[model samples]
Target: MDINMKKILLLGMGLSSVFLLSACSWIQPLPGAFNVALLEEKDVTGCTKLGTTTSSVLSHVGLYDRDTAAIKKDLILLAKNEAVNMRGDTIVAISPLQDGRMEFAIYDCVK
Candidate 1:
């Protein structure tokens, strides 16, 4: 490869890395989101169902795949934030992560 071509390729790779890393930080826990509890269906007994929430984030940056753990973590945070919006204090995953999306059941189980 020519020197110019090499420089361009390296720059592209560096930019892609930056974009992927920055994307991870784009999802933040909203107020009260951290207080929301993640529980299993068995533990949500007697809790009032407040509907469900689905969260989706970037699963890939261009051709490179993002970290699965980071994607799952962001998905959880997004779900918790949605749960808080529905006046729910707890959440239970209703579906596994797929296509960077996951479903969660929100419940008001504070009582």
Candidate 2:
């Protein structure tokens, strides 16, 4: 009877030890302890196109530089004028090309 009792006690203790050790392992931090949850991506848009126009103020020998300056001023004025006309939400891209030409674009970025 004593032998049987000892055998049962040993089996119970072994089973409990196994369960306790398994539970203890789960208490420790995992390999990726610092892992963070991923965030959802957000939509974003920027300038995608450009438009340009040019006006010839004058064309004469030895005065090309002066004409070029005038053309640049006119293009700048035009761009400012167009920019003011934009209302609410607007995206704009501006660029200047050779020979007194200006380029820019504006588009609705939000849907």
Q: Residues 1-111, candidate 1: write the lDDT tens digits.
A: 999999999999998776668456577788999999999999999999999988999888776677888888899999999998888999999999999999999999977
- List model 2 lDDT by residue over 1-111, tens digit each: 699999999989986765444333112222332231111122224432223233232222332243455455544444434433442123232454465455645333433
Give the RMSD in angstroms, all C-alphas superposed, for model 1.
2.9
Task: Report the Cα lDDT for candidate 2.
Answer: 0.39
Clashes of each: 0, 0
Alpha-carbon lDDT of model 1: 0.89
Which regions in candidate 2 have their CA more than 4 angstroms from the true location? Answer: 1-62, 67-73, 88-95, 107-111
Which candidate has the top score in TM-score?
1
- Cα lDDT for residue 62, model 1? 75
Residue 38 displacement (Å), model 2: 36
Which parts of model 1 are misplaced by more than 4 Å? 1-23
True lDDT of residue 62, candidate 2: 39
